[model samples]
Target: MSTFSRLGGLLLAAALPLGAQAELPAERIEPSIHAELAAHTRHFAQQIYRVAGNVHSAVGWQLGNVVMIEAPEGLIIVDTGESVSESRKIMAEFRKLSDKPVKAVVYTHFHPDHINGVQAFVSREQVERGEVHIYAHETLLQNVVAQGALVGPILGVRSAYSFGSFLPASDQEGMNAGIGPLAKAEPSSFIAPTVTFGERLDTRIAGLDVQFLHVPSEAPDEIILYLPDNRVLISAEVDQGPTLPNIHTLRGTRFRDPVQWVESLDKLRAYRAEHMVPLHGRPVSGQDKVEEVLRMTRDGIAYIHDQTVRWMNKGLTPDELVEKVKLPPHLAGYTPYLREYYGTVKHSVRQIYNGYLGWFQGDPVALDPTPPRQQAERLIALAGGREKLLLEAGNAYLKGDYQWAAELAGYAIRVDHDDKLAREIKARSFRKLGYASMNINWRNWYLMSAMELEGKLDGDAIRQRSVEMREVFLSPDMVRSFTPQSFLQNWVTRIDPQKAGDLELTLGFSFPDVDEQWALEVRRGVAQLHKGIPEGTELRLSMDKRFMETLLTGEGGLVKGALLGDVKVEGNLLEIRRFLACFDFADEAFGLTLR
Candidate 1:
């Protein structure tokens, strides 16, 4: 059976029956803040003719529209949609625009929504036919590979929260209120580029003079392309309206450099183009409008940055900063472009602190902390009883004091796990929190956690679909940064002193389509991975790229999978097992506590 099947069966067996008791219907999500979707809708409708191509993203995500430029020599495709299915939709629309084949594809960045769907426009064979070129910033490839290694599992889990992927399409459950609709289309087979450049690359393609500017702040590998003749600037993913950047995505990843993100906006201001197209939202036309939007975006970031730094310098904690900071009236109103949809100012401020100070607030007390459960149990006893705590939390929830309600209810649940009333009250508090959040990630997390508590967990059947890892290609440097964190927990557990220097194994990983290979070495208790196979290696574990991923992720146990004949182990089997035994399983349950 497939890995998905085995995991699915196990989860399903453990799942609380859907009919155990109907969960209280999800409350209507209130739009606490304005969003950019409305403005984009109006703008796109007004400029439909200028739109060269468009694609429907999927059932649960916003639809992606593309504008293609056909020049005398070839074609320039902009803003590839989310995945293979979404890309096909774009191609179908491309047919409507013009029959010219795509000569080159320009990626805004490596975001799944923008770069995952390029294959629909042209085949790998056609690109190799020397008829097409894929263009992106120098860092784009690096970001793609780094993100690809973990995107599957992180997206697989957090996607459930962001897109309501497992929620049924019913009125009370899976309504597309959060991140609009999620793109449910199948992921495309990834295709890596045959060409790349540093700093800037000025090239002519499809009869258009394309000037690529490297912006490494928002995305280390992001590029903003300029069409000098058309006076159009493809802003890529950098300037997606005025909402705060998803600096620290809840779905999980390294912290984005917000300071550099501000710098990227300044770089974009130099373009002074008449038309600007973002990867996720509506395009801007006219120099004045583009400038206005860009200026506001810059100011928005500045406002957050300045205030955060001022407070940080004054020795304010993240919690104090969140409570004290507020946007000026000029920055407060809801503009479709400035709405907090994906990220919010409050969270962004916290991220800025984290990025600069590295989580230590210069407070020695914070260096070590008491465990949350132990503290919660003591607090519950001080509160008299779990029932009293639940009642108080429920009262607070009804009074719009969701933060306190959540805290108290959490303590009650921690104190008495079997207290169904406490769980119900806590879940209800989470529901309310979800209803009031403007950030889609926050809403999904709050709501999804509530759903799981109420015995309505969405199954993981969707992860079965195969995704071409190479399509979301990564650069060598990015791969190195990614491997350590992705497998840190597992690696830490598998180390054994007796076997420290007893094993030296080399494994080759190949992705034929992308023409990439990496040599992974296990020496002593440490793992050293490189671009090619190392010399005189005791073991040569050759395998498909995806299989290596499965092993790395701990989704497929190395020893068990090898024993089951799913993975090939060519060296000393005993050493391989010994090496595998060093890694420890991550306990996700720890996150549930307050600590």
Candidate 2:
């Protein structure tokens, strides 16, 4: 039998119990508590109740629940659902309860799910009229603007895998599994916040004493609003039940401060609210329960932080720490809440260590690394022929030893991508690992990698659309960091920096409804990125941000397109050409280089 057939049969044999397959009521929320809340508030037009998300069972991406707090002023909405569509559905349900206008909207963070559906609640004109005040942290505007163009699109594509958006909706696949329902796509629209505050802001809206706390941990732009009168706390993404917080997201981004994250948790612990509502997942009530959950969460982060640092001090490698680290029994018991649905402990610990100590773990050998493919080929040659490796890999697969199978097959495929048998074995091994992972992010990563090997990668539409690079205003540090990744030294050598002597170039980049300008100075082979207009210099280049991204990625070229006027260059055109020449196209053939 084929490997797929055998794997399919094994999965079929492990099917869930008959009770698991039976679908619950269409509109019924799970864990029963939420359903009871919905039932209790069914008849009351202006009643407040907590809706449960997938809290007790699953983790990550599953929103908690929305607070239905109706007042004589109007229906004051806290957080919309996870997506624009989900938010629309939630608003529809709210309309069923009352015909009141959504007086105001408040977002906990800039995560797509939380703030993507403002149009559903109120029109732009209503918000403009000061009738509806969309409130968030002052930094929320910066976060939204930062992610508006390229970053947003890139994240949206990766999110498909992170959230299992394309997975088959089977009980064994995409069912609630505790984190709420999974779907392929969500209709979303970005709405900029109309009002923002720096620190703590208290105001009365819709008969509620809404106190906004600028909690800069989970997200620097996140705000946790407390309705003191109702004793309800709206925590954006900061306090997510008991799960290990994603200090550094795997799909990629800046290193989140673990210390700050813990401090923020401590702040929430002191709130003393009777009820807590999170952006995703279910609500937690009762003071003791809230404290217990908060403690578990705080301790979980502390455990990873303390243990990882302890190991780091002991000269332990990242790999060594991953194997040795374990949460205590008290923390471990919160498995339902502490599952690696988003961030795995192993990865989280690594990030914590990196954030504090930097990458080098006191090992000189780790200072610079050789490419993986080159090393893999050498290892394969040392292990005899490829066929021998394949045979051993097959044995491992049959024994259900996926880790060994993956390791062997990875080496085999790296040695030769045309090796069909090795690729097949690697793909199946990854699927098995994905199937066994409770951490949804890990599952998605493994599965996505496997799909690439099998040539079944999805979500290409978003990937194909090049984002306007200029729309994202990167800080000088951010731009410097991106230089090594975006442009290689070899490409840099191609450009004659000597020809572009102390040239100052200004480019006014604008997107539809978005505007920003970059002032660049090229001198002595260094390019400095700055904001605002440039001073006197050699040239000025004007183009849309999308076109700039395409040019940088080699999908389009500056000199070739400049003639067509797709890119316009004024002043010293030759100097601009010299600057372009300084960048070398990245060597795609150099597989497994330090990323």
Candidate 3:
């Protein structure tokens, strides 16, 4: 049987009957609502759903939902599908409804899935030439560049694990991404917004009067749109799917202000939208239901945030508050929409605490606690070392006490990474834990951890491969804006001092296309940049700005460029090669669950 079947069987065996009076442990009980609703793709996938008057949504075509508003002149596209190919498919189906030219595009947020597919609807030249306009929050560009360019290498892999990026597109493993279907990992065709707004912007585009509200919810750069004519509200990530809002996502990011998130929900509620279209998932029609969902979502967030603060005032720690602050029975409605598919109550509670109180948990012991490996070693020693711990962990796994088994095996493996038996036991434990998890993100992470332990998943390989692809795919426009000094400073700080070995080299680069010139001087693992070529440059390299961009982007790579006549060298090739080799740029991947 497949792992999914085995897991489902195990879950069924462990879980109590629905008629039972007592509550099953959160770990054992599968969230029926999430499995039922998130997996209900047949109802809308590949269908142009008429959400409300003149509004249509193409759901399940990609990671992000595409909503089209038919206006007098053309269609106002909101949050294009995740990729150019994805948008092509979605828009093909969308065109069956209407073939109007896209007058404007509104980016709901800076998330790649929401904004990267702009090239599909309109050409970059049109957007650049002011023929077509794209609007987004003022901070969207900076936020996108920061997340996609600066920290993309790290975020890319973490996101891969969280979203089951590498997992096959099947219900047996990776099926749905809480908000939408599995994201296709294709090259993102990101077109920067031509217009930006702050706070709110009321504008008429495509002969449709719309109100854009800058509501920072899932992302600080997020926004929602309201069409007064249709009484429709396009809630971007705010209502991304029906799942409980991910106030805190597993992929690391800045802490989301629960207070601000709640306020954003309120702003949407004020619209009293008869038809509510989310950036993901299906839309909701009927003024009453929309109002109810809006209110319930707001209340849920407020309950978590307000109660977390209330308990914190009583000196309750985050851990304590997470357990104590659950939705009251009256407020915890039995709606599939309110279920924790992406975010759980405990995590939301903790995030609420973190938003107010930083990572310091007030315990000095925690402030200077023993390192994880050392603590594991000490624990293993106390428990009769690796063999004893592995044996106990194995016993626990056999008894279906996966949490305990994983805990014991974790300690044993941490103390001695070569403990093969412990690693196998821990992998089994995590597999069970993953199978039992209601949150898909947790399930993916747990299963990924199990795979990592078994050497099935190579996080390092993924990171390194991602680095190469990202380097080539990163926009040249963004890279060109980087000043020589800033670029050199960043590389210099990352240089390994011990790798210097008394080597000193200088290289000059001239880019005629952009009229930019810079020279690099390296000594003892330290590097400095000079504007224009310095008089005593040991070697000189000249190339078109586009060629330089390609070299930096790893297009043909440096060696290939030199051999292919893409780059010209005026000095010794060995010297240039040696100079390039001096910089240590090894890709390093960090452990997630293992640590």
Candidate 4:
């Protein structure tokens, strides 16, 4: 479980076509959509553009772009990249252009693609020594630490599916990840910021007049960098490259308020800079071109936001709004940037509906419906029989009604989870729908779900792969960025109630090297973490800082270390085992997909 599983390549080689009708019908892939995605290959090809003056953007090197602003004495970098390995390649090329030391590093947002490459530019020692300064929004640190918290496990799975991590690296399948090329690995290097600003900050970095504004868009802590004297605007994710902006991402995100995104775009437009550099795609020069892109990007966001609200106000359900709300003809074809390669109006409209009105759309019938499997069983009965229902599904698939066929197959599956025929029919429908999808996320999710349904992927294997993603995400450098307090705080949910519910115990921890003392108190099913050691404790254990780091990074095990004399123990060493036993490390049943 330490390496990413390439499940697509491991697919059963002798697997048969999903059903007897697999070759009966032609696919309905839109030629224009396919061509549009293909054309973006050129847009994201590896290259570095001299945006304007001393500002250069290295695009297509990783999922997020990196910008370098040169100064007479040093260089300023914004958004490192997805990983140390990927950024090292780009850093080599950047060095050929400038020989100055990196004076400061700034992050556009807290997304991994933008921050994981920090060590490639400068080390933590340099920052600690006051030689290099790291700049970011004040809220960025909290979000970065949250990556290892409760929701992290599931977020990793959803992100991998959206990024096509499990798909083959071929032109027909995983050609382009829509944002940038997928990284070979998710290795990360994180450093806490040295300088953080709240809403806005104006200062001089490397002798350039710099302004950072907290504009919430793609990410909560998103900040745009503007050089007042250089007249250059670095429009981070605020202007997500040449595609329909993902006002709402399929890979689940913080509440992305469409209106707030539009407002943030307005904030960028106020700069009136002559040059605009976006993190995902090419840079734009000239006031007219920059303004057009900014306006179109914001207008596209506003159109989706307004229209969804319009229909939602009419008592329309989310499904109904999906049918009713659409972009006007002008906006739909306005610019290539508005193309639905990354985000589609279909998904965007649904999120807006949920934001305004909750999951229940005033439908009392949905309050307490029959359980899923029972309802599906009744559906099979209503359709005369299982064979007849499966037959109807095959007929619909042959007629190119893939969605309806998939729905029917789903009911059949809900009746019996292991119906081979029903699974095959559903997998067939998913393959068709995947190839016909207009957005990258939709296409990838559909294709991945098909793989899961066809027995090409094993549940146990997928679960292990998802769990291994933690190693890449919480790399050694990332683990080092956490304070003992923050690191142990994420483990609060892992307390085993069955073991610790009736027991009351306090365990003291001392790290003499780091001069940090912490304690964990378990009382009646509740676990409390304290920054300082409690006054009285039943057991006390001291650990070297280096040994503690190894434990956090998964380099060693706690029980093994205690037995190996790597940990200092006092007051009944067996109590160490008792404390460790109170936590649950057993893997849960859910993983990448619930079905």
Best by TM-score: 4
**Positional deviation of residue 533's Cα in model 2 after best superposition, in angstroms:** 4.0
Q: Where does candidate 3 clash, by residue pair?
A: none
Lowest-sum lDDT 10-residue window in model 1? 52-61
- Candidate 4 CA-lDDT value: 0.79
For candidate 4, write residues 457-573 as lDDT tens digits: 676767766765655566677666677777677667879898887878888888888899999888867789988887767587788777777877668776788789887776776
- The digit string of per-residue lDDT tens for model 2 on 1-595 reads 5556655443332232212122211121011112322222222222234433211111233243444556557767665554555555666666767787777787777665565555667776887788887777877655654553335445544555465444443312323323333431444444556777888899887765678888877677778877666676767677764355676676566677777778888899898877777655556788787777777887888788888888888988888998888887777667555655556688987887778878777768767776778878888777765656666776787688988988887886776665556666676777877766666566666666666665454224224311221122222212222222132222323434564455544332222223655555455666555554456544666666556556544467767678787777777666666556554342221111011
- Go through the candidates in order and give each one's C-alpha lDDT: 0.60, 0.58, 0.73, 0.79
Clashes of each: 19, 15, 0, 0
Best by lDDT: 4
Q: Which candidate would rank higher by lDDT, 1 or 3?
A: 3
Model 2, global lDDT: 0.58
lDDT assessment of candidate 1: 0.60
Q: What C-alpha root-mean-square deviation, in Å, does candidate 2 show against the real structure? A: 9.9
Error of 4 at 509 (Å): 3.9
Task: Name model 1 segments beyond 4 Å from true.
Answer: 1-65, 150-152, 171-181, 242-244, 416-418, 458-525, 529-573, 580-595
Please give the TM-score that candidate 4 achieves against the real structure: 0.88
Each prediction's TM-score versus the true structure: 0.78, 0.75, 0.82, 0.88
- Whose TM-score is higher: candidate 3's or candidate 4's? 4
